[model samples]
Target: MKKIKLGNSELEVGEISLGCMRMNELSKKDAAEVIENALDCGVDLFDHADIYGGGESEEVFADAIGMNDDVREKMKLQTKCGIRKGFFDFSKDHILESVEGSLRRLKTDYVDTLLLHRPDALMEPEEVAEAFTELKESGKVRYFGVSNQNPMQMELLSKYLKDDLIINQLQLSLVHTPMIDAGFNVNMQNDPAIVRDSNVIEYCRLNDISIQAWSPFQHGMIEGPFIGNEAFPEVNAKLQELAEKKGVTDSAIATAWILRHPAHIQPVVGTMNKGRLQDIVKASDIELSRQEWYELYRAAGNDLP
Candidate 1:
């Protein structure tokens, strides 16, 4: 439970943050127990979203916080907006309304960070900037960032917005890391797959924007969990070997693979299992060497060059 300074923001957040997307279906007591476990393990950053479980996730997280006032003050809370069921909206009205709803749901006056859930094709940078300015001036949101945005989109927003873009949440995992893999196999003909994310990893790092990796243990986009999936037998075999060597769970090994990168990425874990949460916290301490890091990368079939 080490802390890292968020990009250009004075907020020091835990290296591993807890994602509450799945807690909407859990009982209030159970959700409270899970959040308590995270706090006990030194996890201080809790991630939420307005669209997760149709806004029930934020309510459950707020209930957990209400169970303990002292804990609420000790942890940093972050949530995302701008995603609706049918389309994306970054309108000034939507942003303002969403933050108000989030504050009411989380039972907090201000969020540590507020992210635009996804890029809206028709987003007007000026409207977004106005919303941010109003929120910052009103003391509703302390920091701002974006999720699933490329460098060009970020630059577009930065051009009109006055606040620093602090983070970019991206779908990154050991098996589905096209952002890292595409660069290695850049010149392969007949490979439209060779071009993905437009080198977002390097772009964010160079621009001083922190990268938060979501779905860190998934093999693909919601197809299934990769922790024990049979399709990735070879990958699981290597994970087991590393887990044994590091004296941590295979899930931790998977998380470590993401953390071992020099980009200083934070893994926003979506696990609800208390044991799994503890294992991920332990994974942060298991530093993989350069060779071991690439070993897992190659095992995951990313060694094109």
Candidate 2:
């Protein structure tokens, strides 16, 4: 896999990141196989959230990987906090407590990156800055980021953060692409013109925040993967054609579509199936051209004009 600098941070990571949200469902043996497969595929970043499987995913991952410092040093581990049982929390108390929980579960002293899993409406940036300063000073978290956040939201948090927010994880894919759609349909009286998330894609690019694309194959927030979903025949056909053309799996074509962007967005693969993980890695080498990228955009029922 290719290596890319994580935003303005000094950490360089794999072009593709593995989302460990599903790890808790697997046994330790299976989880270890998945981790080994991911490592063999050049995936070096593992993304997690405190709420994922009620923190069991991180625990399973730590046990599966043996929590060896020498092995951990070869990869980058990034986990998230800021969400609570029924609400979001970014209080200094919550942030500090959450980090401790994560470290204890992951069996690590410090994570490579710690992200706010989601935005807290009642968040005070000063408290977050204090928590981050403490974490950084004490060697608990090396870098920081956010997930599903907008430009102004980050601007609010960055106001008090001593370090740059290096990442903004977003829900993006070939089908669920409001960000790309809004960029082209701007100033128009159409449904696609709805500027969601304050057009954070361009904003993050301009601000040097790397985007991490989550659920790259999903059709909607909850509709699940679109690869074999019968509702998306056009997209499935297009993906099949490209997959055969490139001698890669259809899943790789879907993943490559996201990585094709100049933003250098990292697609966080959530699959635990070893075969599927190997297939997804094929995306790292196939760079989609401008026409191919737009073809996919249109195939997913997106209108250019």
Q: Candidate 2: which stretches are off by over 4 Å?
A: none
* Model 2: per-residue Cα lDDT over 1-305, one tens digit each: 88899999999988999999989999999999999899999999999888899999999999998988897887899999988879999999999999999899999899999999888989999999999999999999999999999999999999998999999999998989888888898789999999987989999899899999999888789878899889999999999988988999989999998888989899998999999888899899997888988888899898878
**Model 1 lDDT per residue over 38-79, tens place:** 988878888999988888999988886573456568888899
Best by the lDDT measure? 2
Global lDDT scores for all candidate models: 0.88, 0.92
The runs of at least 3 residues in candidate 1 whose Cα sits more than 4 Å from the true structure, single-residue gaps closed, are: 67-69, 190-193
Candidate 1 whole-model C-alpha lDDT, 0 to 1? 0.88
Model 2, residue 31: C-alpha shift (Å): 0.7
TM-score of 2: 0.98
Query: How far is 56's C-alpha from truth in model 2 (Å)?
Result: 0.9
Give the per-residue Cα lDDT of candidate 1 at 185: 68
The TM-score between candidate 1 and the true structure equals 0.96
